[model samples]
Target: MILCCGEALVDMIPVDLPAGGKAYAPHAGGAVFNTAIALGRLGVETGMVSGVSTDTFGRMLASQLEENGVSTAYLARSGRLTTLALVHIENGGATYSFYDENSAGRSLTFADMPALGDEVSALYFGGISLVAEPAADAYASLLAKERANRVVMIDPNIRPGFISAEHTYRDRLDRMIGQSDIIKVSDEDLDWLIEGEETIEIKAAAMRGRGPAIVVVTKGAEGATAFFGDASVGVAAPVTHVVDTVGAGDTFNAGFLAGLNDKGCLSKDALGSVSDDVIHHALSLGATVAAVTVSRAGANPPWASEINR
Candidate 1:
């Protein structure tokens, strides 16, 4: 079983008018939530640990997760407003301007972390959950408790502009990084984490020394690369007639975790010694899922059959 712990929110995507303008269309989103839903849709055992809201939008988000087969036994609904991301789509890609701060997700506490049964193999986390206060501290604590049994994966999915430049968000993030076993970072995410530092080897080595045994750097269009210990493997992105890249990376994480679980190698140390064939299989799965996601309008990923094909 894989447990995803983070925010479950709504993305208000822009729909272009025939007259050449835009409007907001609400869709369920949040990096960890998307990954959990995708994994559940693929027939994998999955659960989500996060806070929801009592509002209608939050209800819709929770319903979507349940419909996709994600277990929400650990979900907490509060009176606070649900987080929102006003996503803008243009030129076949989407960019987000978030409206998150003191939202329900940010109000989480360490007591909210669900007990991972012996069946739970990995813990996945990402997005702005690492940026807020009580929730950030709470998630970091979750990583500590799960460090011995389950693999911990983190995708920063950084929103630099949303965070205060004055505060040391980076330093706080580094603590979580040190607790993770795997870290998936996009080119844009890396740039946001540390400007002008594009050296994969250097970044991977530095991050590995901190904690993560494996580091994956995703390059849009160009594909992605994975670093395990001192070795690295690169995989080119699969061809696709692009639509929108709303949940591509999140789905990619789901695919990778799915592949790892299928191989009976869900532990952090095991991932570092994966063979070339296994790495190729994992990367292919990730690319396939990402391709399916990019073809959709919002954060919706294709069914398992589409990924298999």
Candidate 2:
């Protein structure tokens, strides 16, 4: 089983105002949660570990997870209010304004961590969970403890607005990047984090030096590039009329993880030598899953049958 650890929150998306009043629609989101569901839907044995409120929204999120075949046994319920992200769409693309500080999901700590055994083959974590306090420390500790146990994949999924530039997050992020066996980043994230970095190879080389055995940088619409030690490969993203890119990248991680696990390349050393054919196959699966996600609204993805895998 692949374990995804992080936030599970509600994304309230804006809709056109009616009579000078704005309206919003609630959707289940949070990068880790979305990836967990997409992985489960792809027939990957997956589970989620995080905090959720006992409130209505939390119940709905849990239901959504179970419905999609993701186990929520490790989900902790609290009386605190569920975290919310206000999603704004412009020109057919989406951006999010978070409301997670001190929210229920942010309250998760090391005490709440579940015992991960040999049943778990890989561990996935990222997003704002790496920025906050006791939770952040706890997650970092968990990653450190598991570094020698399984395939560790990290996707920063950075949102500048949600993080404090003065809080030493960069140092922490750099350390986490080193601890990760696989690291995925977006073009925007790279620009924000790397500063004026041009070539994917340059960025990947810099990131690989930090620790990740394999580094993947995604270019929305254009495609993605991958790096493993001295080797590199680039694959063009599949074309599709994107509906909303909410869970596209998260599902891309899920698909790539699933494909790697299926191909028995979950180890850092194994991924470091992945062939171009394997890389493209993995990217195709990732893009396919993400394509299905973008075709629909929210973080929902295609079921296993739809892909006929």
Candidate 3:
């Protein structure tokens, strides 16, 4: 099983109401949460580790995870309110305004982290939870403790707006990256992390030097590239009718991880020794999944059946 650790919250998406004015509709989402859901739908054995509320929205999040075949055994239940992200769509893209102060997902502490079982082969972390409060520290603690035993993959999913203290956030993220087996970043995230000092390939090479055996830089519409050892491989994005790019990246992470898992290349050793063919296959699967996600509305991902078809 692959365990995803981070925030679980509600996304208030804008909808065109029949009454003329727009209304916001709630959707269970969060970067890590969406990735877990996508993994489950793709028939990967998955579970979630995060502080979740017992409130309506939290229950909805939990129920959605269960319905999608993700194990909730690692979730820390709280009476605290759930986090809310108001998503504004413009030009087929989405931006977020978060209201997370004192929320269940943001209130997690180190003590709230669950013990991982032997069934878990990999642990995935990232998103707003990595920058949010006590929860961020809690996740960092868990990552440190589990890195030795499981394959670790992290996607910072850098949201410039959510960061309050740049230095602290960078320190935490850097530590996590050092301990991770694979690190996935977007073109924008790479620019933010490296400050455009070098080419994307060069930046990814620097990141690989930190510790991760593989570094993946994703380019929206242009597909993704994987850097390992002294070589890199690129895959072009699949053709699809774009609706919105809400969870496209998150689903891509799921697909990439799932592809690795399917190929029995999820372990740190296996990933370090992976071949170009495996890298190409993984990136292709990720692009296919992202295509399926962008061709739909919201963060909806395709099921294993759809992918198989």
Candidate 4:
């Protein structure tokens, strides 16, 4: 089973009513939450680990997970309010304004993280949870503690607005990156992390030096490239209708991991010997699923039955 550790919160997406101005619609979202949902819908045995609130929005979040076949077993409850992201979309590109201070997911501490059972073979972490205080440190601690024998994947899913203390967050994130076996980053994220005149390949290689065996870099609407040692594989994005790209990257993460898991390349040792052919297959699967996700509104990922690939 894969355990996704990070934020689970509400996304207030705008909906235009026929009668008047736009109103916000609550959607169960958060980078890790979306990936967990995508994995579950793809028929992967997955569970979410986060500090969920008992409030109405929080209950909605949990219910959505169960509805999508994602396990809520690892969630810890609190009386705190749930976090909310007010989304703004311009020509299908999305940005967020978060309201998360003192919220359940944001206030989580190390003590709130659940003990991992042997059933969990892989762990995934990223997003605002990695930028938010206390929770960031807690998740970094979990990564440091339990990554010994398990395959670990991380995507920073950087949102600059969520960051408070840059140095502290970078230190914690660097630690997690070092412990992770697989690292995924958007082209924008890569540019931000490693600013230079060097080629993208060079920067991605730099990320590999930080410790991950495989580095995946995504360029929205263009394609994605995966660097394994000195070899690299690229996959083109499937053409699809435009919709908000809310959970596209998160879903891609799930699809890629699911493909790796299916091929028995989900172990830290297996990754060392995994072939480029296997990585190509995984990248195609990821692109296929992400295409489906971006074709729809919000963070909804297609079920395995819906996929023809």
Candidate 4 lDDT over 1-309, as tens digits, reads 999999998999999999999999988899999999999999999999999999999999999999988889999999999999999999998999999999999899999889888899999999999997888889998899999988999999998777878888888888899899999999999987888788889999999999999999999888899999779999999999968798999999999999898898999889998999899989998999999999999898889998864
116 Cα displacement, candidate 2 (Å): 1.0
- The CA lDDT at 151 in model 1 is 89
Per-residue error at 282 for model 2, in Å?
1.1
TM-score of 1: 0.93
Worst 10 residues of 1 by lDDT: 160-169
Pairs of residues clashing in candidate 2: none
Best by lDDT: 3
Ranking by lDDT: 3, 4, 2, 1
TM-score of each: 0.93, 0.94, 0.98, 0.98
In candidate 4, which residue ranges exceed 4 Å CA deviation?
A: none
Candidate 3's C-alpha runs over 4 A off are none
Clashing pairs in 1: none
Lowest lDDT 10-mer window, candidate 2? Answer: 159-168
Per-residue lDDT of model 1, residues 161-239, tens digit only: 6677425678777888887888899977766665565576676676678888778888989998888755788889989
lDDT score of residue 20 within candidate 1:
92
Model 2: runs farther than 4 Å from truth?
A: 17-21, 165-167
Pairs with backbone N, CA or C atoms under 3 Å apart (clashes), candidate 4: none
